[model samples]
Target: MARVLVVDDDKNTLKFVRLHLEEEGYDVIEATDGRDALKKLKTLPCDIAVVDVMMPFMDGISLTKEIRNTYDIPIIILTAKDQIDDKAVGFEAGTDDYLTKPFETKELVFRIKALLRRYVDSESDNDPIRLGNILILHENYSIKIDTKTIKLPLKEFELLYLLAKNSQRVFSREQIIENVWDLDFEGDNRTVDVHIKRLRQRFSHLSVPFSIRTVRGVGYTLEMNQ
Candidate 1:
């Protein structure tokens, strides 16, 4: 059974969510606030976390950032506000998905299952990906090149992993966006370009044996230097 961490200040909300999740055969962990959530995370391993935006001690955004920094688990942010800006803030804070308050427990369950499916599929292979001298560690979300270890933000790391894993295969901008970001991503195709640029900039000085090449009018591919 998958373990889920549900963090919210409202006792009723926690009970409501925990009940539904437990019904779905998930091992549920409850935290009244962000600080308490972090404490629970330290002791118990959770596959995913559902965090509310409003909480004492640490807000959901701050808690999400902290979790992203330390754990590889997916996060879903819940809020009463349905504003696009609010969602942008949640995504920026490293949340994999977002849910507004007064949501149906069934919808939340679907989202949880979807996120779990994606994460489990991505990690189905436990071996680290290697391209020439570059090592992509999916376990810790870090990369090793030669003697250097570099940590990238979650999105950047995922982008690089997708490209490197399918090296030499050209992925259209649409495909890249759909795979790296969610299908509901509000950003434009330029988002892919921006991430590609950052990845190139990050490794430009390194002695790597691969390159991310843009196929004019098509998309991008990671090419091994020959």
Candidate 2:
């Protein structure tokens, strides 16, 4: 059973989340604020954390920064702020997923399951796969080059993994959507473009000898310069 730490000042919100998660068979731990949550986590082992962005002391963003620096577990940001900028800041602070306020219990459960499946229960095969100079650790969903290691979000990591595994092979937009986001994704097809753009920018900063390129009308591909 996976232990989850949920941090929120709102008692009603905490109760609601705990109820659903406990019903799903998760061992739930609750905290009233980020400071309290951080103290608990250091002594208690948890698989993941569901955090709220606004709180009395040490907001979610600050807590996320501290967690990223010290903990390996994934974090899901639960905030009422649904703006793109807020979401981006959360991601920048190392959150793996984000959920807005006023969300359904089923949706919350699904996101938790999705993240756990991606990062925790991943049954990735070990095959010493190298894309250019970077090493792909499938099991950890991390990439390494020299002494540096990078952890990416689930979608960006999956897209990079798929393209890197295939090398020069191009994946169509529809195929990518079906593979990464799955069929139930209600978002428009343009989301793939958004992810691809992010992947390109991140990879570029690393000075990797590879590029994620658009195939015009076809889709996209990872081209390695060797």
Candidate 3:
């Protein structure tokens, strides 16, 4: 499910938006003001953020700027102000879509889905995985970090590719083996760990700390700073 953050000063507005988003099978996180919104955003991972333009403590424009600076996640601006300048300012602050107040719940839902589709489709268009200072050319099965080139065996390369493809999400060793290696590869799960360790070593010299994290008793994840 997609995680969405809704920010609005009015309690009624926040509740209403959260209820509608939950009804649509989305995981909703809410904040009553822009400052609260930023705090919540940093605590959890979210796919998109819905922000109200006229918020307390900080406005949507400022909040959008902060979000854009740290993450490439999609943002939709919700507001009572419908002026052209207001819309332009939101876009300038990196909002992916704009919605005015009193919008129909269905219309809001549609806009959110459209924005998400566009963002996801753009990522798919890239074909290869690129993050921070590292790039993995999946089609060519090659990897590079800035001006440095790294070599990998087929197994190691495939393992790195899968982790980087799904970047921040955790994956169990069994899941990694099934997707990166053969479905029926009867090797020990430890093989997955070995390759991940090697890949991290090659990337440790880069500016961004790209590490393969071990989620104890759960799995592993590639956490790249970008």
The per-prediction CA RMSD against the true structure, in angstroms, equals 4.1, 3.2, 16.5
TM-score for every candidate vs. truth? Answer: 0.72, 0.78, 0.55
- Residue 172, model 1: lDDT of 97
After aligning candidate 3 to the native by TM-score, how far in Å is the CA of 43 from where it should be?
A: 1.3
User: What would the per-residue lDDT of candidate 2 be over residues 1-226, giving only the tens digit for each residue?
Assistant: 8899999999999999999999999999999888999899989988889999988989998998888777877788887744545566676676767788888989988988887877765563645578667898878878998779987766677778888888899999999989876887544556677778777777776778888888999999988876
lDDT score of residue 171 within candidate 1: 98
Residue 144 in model 1: shift from native, Å?
Answer: 2.2
Query: How do the residues 1-226 of candidate 1 rate in per-residue lDDT, one tens digit apiece?
Result: 8999999999999999999999999999999988999999999989999999889999999999899888888898898855545666776666777788789999899889987876766455646898888789877778999889987765678888888889889999999989887787655676677678768888998899999998999999999999
lDDT of 3 by residue, 27-137 (tens): 999888888988888888788889888877899899988887776577878866445466656655656566777788898888778656645553444376777777786
Q: Which stretches of candidate 2 lie over 4 Å from their true place?
A: 81-85, 122-128, 171-175, 186-207, 214-219
Off by over 4 Å in 1: 122-129, 137-142, 147-156, 166-173, 181-226
lDDT of each: 0.85, 0.81, 0.74
Error of 2 at 211 (Å): 1.8
Rank by TM-score, highest first.
Answer: 2, 1, 3
Q: Identify the runs in model 3 with alpha carbons over 4 angstroms from their true place.
A: 122-226
The 10 consecutive residues of candidate 1 with the worst lDDT sum are 81-90
Q: List the residue pairs that clash in candidate 2.
A: none
lDDT over C-alpha atoms for residue 175 of model 1: 96
